[model samples]
Target: MSFEDEWAECQKTANQRSTRMQLNQTPDGNYRPGRAPGGDLVVHDNELGAIGNEAYGLYQHLRTQGDEARPATFAAATAMTSSSLSLGSALYQVHDNWSTQLGSLKEACAHISNHLDYSQKRHKEDEARIATGMHTVSKLYDYFK
Candidate 1:
């Protein structure tokens, strides 16, 4: 059989099979083995900070390097179109699409970085507030004692 035929047959067979996705619990609703009783998930601050830093770095790199070809591509497209070559329009379209997709990717990276940074800062603030409240409560109890 040809590659396409074989690929299609494989896809059909795969689709016919059952696919199960269990998150935190088994299909019968019990917690999965080795999972915490409450299925609690933990994330450390340093991990989040690292992820945020990486995203920021990627954003900065894309901002600087992603458009390195734009000027040349635009000039080529303009030259081609001016020369009445139909390929120029296609090139222009490709350039436009690249710019749009690049913009979206950059925005996503920025959003991830900013959100993680915000989350880290907000969590620290919350911890400080809780600690201060507990200290105040302890002081009040001591005064009463």
Candidate 2:
């Protein structure tokens, strides 16, 4: 209702979000115990991982080269050429390997389904957290009156 009230509420919610990010966690995908996929706050997807890492490398290289409007210098050209080729080759190999195994990788695909379940459960938990936060704030409003 008042500025002080709003500021306090904002600080309270921000603190709640920080705490949730640190304390909350989703269940791991099924993989026979020590073999489950490793990633935080993401559904496990091998193809996506390969693509993301390659893109990250490329982005870093581009930033280092600078964003010149015209053609880059010889040194920059050489840098980009080598890095791009290496990253592309690695990604291509991974893509080929997965593609070749597509038909025979039925068991691996089943694990993806497990990741789907994990993601859904995490989403529901997050919704509950939001509801709880709202209730807490509502009660705080009554207390401050």
* Per-model TM-score versus the true fold: 0.63, 0.28
Question: By TM-score, how accurate is candidate 1?
Answer: 0.63
lDDT of each: 0.82, 0.51
Which candidate leads the pack in lDDT? 1
Per-residue C-alpha lDDT of model 2 across residues 24-141, encoded as one tens digit per residue: 3233323232233442343334545555555455545544543342232334445555787555555555455544454334434445545555656676687579658856875776
Cα lDDT tens digits for candidate 1, 1-145:
9999999999899777644333345556574434634434434788999999999999999999999999899999999999999999999999999999999999999999999999988877875686577568757756764
For model 1, the superposed segments whose C-alpha errors exceed 4 Å read: 1-41, 134-145
Off by over 4 Å in 2: 1-104
Show the lowest summed lDDT stretch of 10 residues, model 1: 18-27
